[model samples]
Structure formats: C-alpha cells, structure tokens
Target: MRLTRCSGRSCLSWLSTIALTLLAGSTLTAGIALDLQDPNSIKAAASTCAYNLLTFYTGNNTGDVPGNLPAPYYWWEAGAMFGILIDYYYYTNDSQYNDLVTQGMLWQVGPDDDYMTPNQTKTEGNDDQGFWGMAAMSAAEQKYPDPPSGKPQWLALAQAVFNDQASRWDNQYCNGGLRWQIFTFNTGYDYKNSISNGCFFNLGARLALYTGNDTYAQWAEKTFNWTQAVSLMDQNYHFYDGAHTTLNCSDINRVQWTYNAGVFLLGASVMYNYVKCSNVEESDTRTDSLLSQTNGSALWLERVEGILNASSIFFATNPPNVMYEVACEPPNTCDTDNYSFKAYLARWLVASIKYAPFIQTTVMPWVQASATAAALQCSGGTNGQMCGMKWTQGSTWDGTQGVGQQMGALSVIQANLIDQVSVPVTNKTGGTSQGNAGAGGGGGVSTSDPALSQNAITQGSRAGAGVLTCLVLISVIGCSWWMIA
Candidate 1:
C-alpha cells in the first residue's frame, strides 16, 4: 500500500471478499468452527483466536500489499498468511495450519485467492498472486497430509490460481512479467510489475517441479533474469517494478517505496533457491551468489528500518504512544491500508532481529500477548477488548469475525519461534523445555505454534484443544474424502 497516485482503477474490491462468502458452500473438514448456539469466552473465544486466524492465514492474504485493501486491518492475517503457517507446520506438527490454509484456499476469488476465475468486477490486468501464491504452494506441499488431501478443498484453490495466471496470458513486457495494473487509482497504471512477476517466477518454478515441466522453470528463470537485470540498480537496490532505465513509463518507475524494494530482495532470495533446486549446476551457481543477493536484500530492509525508526521518533513526540505520521496507507487502490502498515512493519522489524546479515537487535518482548484472558484483554476497554483498539484507527481487538493485526503479530511470533531453536517449549507435566521438545512438543515432530508459547496462561489449556482438533479433523477428512470418492 502507498500514497494515492493511481488513475481510478481498482482490481480487487470489497465485493471480492464478500463473493467468497457467497459462493464457497464447502466447509472445513477440520471442523474448527462450531454451530454452538452460544459463545464461551474462555474456550470458544480462545478457539476463535486460532480458528479465525487459520482461516485468514490459509487464504494466503497477508504481507505484500494488495492494491485494493491496503489497511493494517488485514495485516496479521496476511503475514501469518504465510510466514507463521510455514514455520508452525514444522515446529508443532499440528493440523491447525493445514485447516487454516486449505480452507482458505477454497475461499479464493481475487488476485491472491487460490481460485482465480474471471471476474468482470476485477481489472483486466490485475490477475497475479505475488508472494502469497508462492507461499501457499510451499505450505500445501510441505504440510498437507496424503490421501484425500486431508481435506480435498485445496485442489480447487490450487487449480484456480493456476488458471488465473494462465488465462492472463500476459507473457509480454520485461520478459513475461505480469501486467499488474491497467491503472492504479490516483496513481497511473504500473505496467510490468516487479513484485507479481517475481511471484509468478517462483510459482512457475514450483509448477515446473511439481508438474515436471521444464518450460515453466525456464520461464521462471528468464523472468527472474529479466527482473534482476532490469529492476536492480545502485548495486541491487530494489524498485517498484524494475529500474528506471528499463522502463518506458515516465513517473511510475521513478517512485520506489521501502517495501517495494524490500520485496525484490525477498523475491530474489527465494527464487534463486528454487532455481538452484532445479539443477545441481544451477544450485552451486545460486549458492555462490546467494550471500551477495541476500546482502542486497538486507540493504533494502535496512533502508525500510531507517524510515520506520524516524517515524517512530515522530510518534514518540506524544507522551504515551500515539501513532502519528506512521507512514501508513488508507485502504484505497493507491494508498495501502494504514492498519496493515503498523501490523506488517512490526513483524518486519522483528524478522530483522532474526535474519538480515547485518544485525541490529531490538527485541521488544513487552508486546507479547498476556497469558490470561483478563491479562490479554486491554485494561481500559469495556467488556473485554484491547486498550490499543481505542487509539487504533479502523478495527478492534474484540470483534470476533477476525482481526488481521492479531494474525500478523501472531504469525511473526510463531515464525520467530519455529525458525530458532532458542524459543522455550513446555511439556504435559508443566515444565520448561527447548528447541520444540519435551511433553509439550506434540510427540516430537515439532511443527505447532501454540506449543512454543513461553507464558503459562497462553500455553496451559491449548494442548487439549489442539489434540482434539487434529483427531476430529483427521476423522472429518476421512469421511469427507469417502463421501467424495
């Protein structure tokens, strides 16, 4: 999301999210949702946190700014959309992520949706999935169980994504880059998009692997090469679409935002890895170049950090902690949704603490959610809500339909825990453990997010719900498959 500079063209719209709700008659075989006539704050409410989170997460709706809805409202749901789910799958060995993602895939309708069907409501060129699609394919392959897919729902979503891109047939411009915008709102049409092209490059590489089609892989490589050659400048600093030199457009290529450049770093790093996997010789070449490329990416991250640090300085002018000039966008085509900015930037800063070759450690542990319901609830808010909600524009912590900010923060924490062995985990006996082990470690496979929470109140009652959810999900999956078969 950025400042409004488009030409009144919006690809994704409110109707898109609502459309999925309209057409998706399918239910989660995991059955995390209940028809229960009443709400249980402790059991049901806690479950609501994960259930809604999983749903948004699975949709692969996080992180990379959607041109349509640019608010922090969906930030957590989107970041955890990929970053959290992938790490947790390996850390906790739980089915929650699967349920979240697979069910989400089934709910596709727009650009990032697994189901990328033609919609008259959408712009002609706005059909790419960006990083979200790449992450979804990765999650499905890594975590999905065998047979009947543990939930046959994913198949439809996957097919939809593939069809969406193939139908675009946008194999022109900067060598197969996706034609991102016919015209971004107040902003003019951003032709030859760098972000979505990189995503397609990644997806194409995966398709080449999964379908064993070298053509797609080659396309991925070529696109990557074009993007790199064209997009990179000033020793690998990223641009919105590509370098200004390679562009025919006037101003569109001139303006490069913090995240726009950072995404290229993220994209290049991931794409190079996939390219290497396709061949041993390529692997070695990529491995040799990986550090340099990652360094470039780190540089972009550093730049982003600089801007955020300055903004936080400005916000600090307030006695308490007021969000001023936070450099967030509104949920319009041109500007990003501001709510998402806070959510995403927070996670990005945390990520820098873990990765990024250049280390700048700033671990703000105070932000962690409280262990108890009362403690977790914001102090000043009435009837159980976050105090921050009052200050935060557009959206609340109490509303249970699901909050993107929570999903974003939760995903970042989960990813942090899973990536590192240092995060403490507990066991059934209620003792301390480490590196995804002991009684709380879910029988040693190590892929669940909930098991790693260090605090007692958060981790205390989750195991039962997790184990039951898994078993019931497995059963439902079996039955769902049998019925389909």
Candidate 2:
C-alpha cells in the first residue's frame, strides 16, 4: 500500500492530531507505524520523525541563536543535529528544513571559517569541532543547496576544518594524534581519544575522495595507523575510548562507544571505495605509491568488515539485533552526548553500504530490526511521539526524551530509505561545491612528509583549571560505574 506523503507543517500537524486522537485510549501505542518494505512509508515516517525532532530546536526563533540549541545541550550538539537534518533532507528530499540547516551551519563557521567559534571555545574539543566539519562535508556530498555567494562554501568549510586540525596534530605527546580537547586549559587536554582522531581521519578520507587530493589520503593513512599503534584499536578492530597523554597513552580506556567504531568504519569504507574507484594514469607513481601504501583495496575491505563484526557488541544478545550504547544504556547512565552516539552508528552503518555494497546483507538486517525497534520506543512525552534512548526495550518507553532521542530515532527510520537515494557525490561525480585546497591555512599535512611535528597549542590562563579537573574526575568515576554496572 502506498503511504501518503506528509508534505508540510499543516499536513503533519493534522496527521499528528489524528494519530494522538485515534490512539488515545486504544491498545495501540501512539508511536508512528513503520512499514519497512515500502519506500513511501519510510519517507513519510522519517518526515514525521524529523518534524518532531525539529520541535525541540529553537535555534530558528527570532531571539535565539540561528544554529544553537538551548541549555543542557552544548554548541557541538547543535552542529551534529544540523548534520542529521542534512541527512534527512537528502534521504527524504524534504526541502522544508534546508534554509534552517544552511543558516545554522554557516553561522558557526567561526572567524577563520573553521568551526572554532569563540562562543564554544572554552568547551570545544577537537571532536566537537570535527562534528561541525563533518556536517559541512555532508552538505557538499549530499548537494544540499549551497550557501549564497561570498559565504564559506561547504567543501572549503570542511577543508578548513581538516587543515586546522592537521596543524594541531600533537607529536609531542602520543607520537601523533589530536587531543580530546583543543585548548590546553580544557579538562581533557591531556587525553588523546578515538572520536577526535576518528573524526579527523574520517574527514581526511572524505576530502581525499571529494577532491582527488593525495595529501588528504596521506594524512588519513597516518591517522589510522596512529590509532592502531597506540592500541586504541585492537587487532580485531574493537575501538576503546582513549587514554591520557600524561601516561604516554599506554593505559587505554577500554570502554567502547558506537560513534567511535562508526566513524572509523565509514572512513575505512570510503578509503576502500576511493582506492577501488581510482583510475589513475600508469605513470603517476606518487598516486600509485599512496594506493599501494594503503594496501590497495584488500586491506580496507578487511578493516570495514572487521569493524562491522566487532560492532555486534553494541547489540543485545537474546533479542540479537537492536543497537544500544554498550557502555551506558544498560545502567541508564548515558549522558547527553552518549545518547546521540547511536544515531551516528546507525547513520554511518547504512552509509557504508554505498561504498562497500557487499556489507548490505549484514548491515540492512541490523538497520531494519533496529529501526523497527526504534520506532516503537517513540511513545513518550506529551505529544506521544517523542523518542526514548533505549531501543532494546522495544515498545516500552524508557521514560526519557530529548533531542538525542529524537535524533537517534529519526536517523535509523530515515536510513531505511538508503537504497532509494544516491550515493555521495564528488567533484568527478558532478558535485558543485567549490573546493579550496588551502582552506584553513597550510593545506593540511604535506603529501610527501609523514611526520606531524607541528605545535598548534595556544597558552591560556588555567584560572578555571581546578573546576575543570574536578568535572573530569567526576566524569571518569561515572564512566567506571557505568562500565562496572
């Protein structure tokens, strides 16, 4: 049966009212009903889910910041939320949120066009900045309408972020990796984590594929090697949290998160696709050497599958296919940030199918089961459509609701339409976003040089360092309890 598309706010509002009224006292729950086999059904469900998710966002209001969310949510999450919206538009072709997404993304490009806006500096980490960068990358790839002329173009924005992060690569501590925090005064400054490095690597591999730049590919290879060398990633491809540079990154934080694995999985898959699709001339030895150095297509395919297999840890054993945060969801200790991690995993997992199509048999089942489970959990809050964080609970709401919950639900449901949309576009594939090779500054690490010896730290007064230290200590203790429980 063909599902009618909910095209605008009025139509969606009327549908929501009818849904709430019909299910008010019925045995049926108030969550959106999803039909997995129907493409129109998936798109309609995603449109409704996206609408509910945007209801929490006041960033588009008259007095509020264009791209920012309210309290309890940080600036970085706003960036991530916009990225989700970009995916929503791409998957469903719903142009309703395009202007909002464009405004939010461009407003936070900071003074230098990197995502280091002064508003988030005190709390901004490398991973934080990288999320915004990834959003810009998505805009370019999805061909989300470009910003008006003279503004920072999507591709250049992504490149600027990559260049800035490449400059901050710290060889002084962990051999060569981005720290968890961008500024020295931040609490996690002494720590080197997977998400930060993963985001950098993810961006590099994508930029390489987008622009056909060997430099981006070279840096991507370096970052992937650094992660494994530091033992953050084991031989089987299980990614750990991170460790303090003070300990020389030897003592690993063994707790794993979905985003960590998801980020690297997409990067590896992109690298695999990039190499397999390269039609370089026989005479270009430098390009040939880069491809050979990455072990050509065989190694990347292995890494992608290895990471996917290891990701089974995030799913339930008895029920068998629903995804959750293995580190925190069991104990109900998922923080605001942890709640959003699964969305990326779900988003990236479906996305990897485009680059590595062989994984579809393995990936789509998980996505289908999880999306089904996720839709049923959206029976919370006054509206009766707000999503809860735990999908493993099935139809029973976990008694929680937030932007993260909604984002997670929207991502997986929309992901069911992955096969219906086009794969990401590149310059060679008719991408229209203008590219700037030297975006942020130095144009990232040199293609010829493998060493990342640049010092990008800025000295700041450690006036609030004590407070930040206490918070970090508390967070670490909380993480321990979650893992132990």
The most accurate candidate by TM-score is 2
Worst 10 residues of 2 by lDDT: 463-472
- Candidates' TM-scores? 0.46, 0.86
How many residue pairs collide in each prediction? 33, 0
Q: How far is candidate 1 from the true structure (C-alpha RMSD, Å)?
A: 18.7
Q: What is the lDDT of residue 70 in candidate 2?
A: 91
- Mind giving the per-residue lDDT tens digits that candidate 1 earns over 273-382? 22222223323343322222434334434443443343243122211232222333222222323222333333334333322212233223212221111112222223
Predicted structure 2: lDDT: 0.80
Error of 2 at 73 (Å): 0.7
- Tens digit of per-residue lDDT, candidate 2, span 1-485: 34566778867665544332232222245467777777877888788788888888998898888889898899888989999999999998889999989999999888888888888989999999999999999999889999999999999889889888887888888788989998889999999999999999999888877777655766788899999999999999999999999999999999999999999999988877766555455445543235545456677768888999999888775345778899999887899888899999999999887777777888877787778778878888887888999887756789988889889999998998897887687765667998665677534543323533232111121111111000011211221100100
lDDT minimum window of 10 residues, candidate 1: 467-476
The best candidate in terms of lDDT? 2
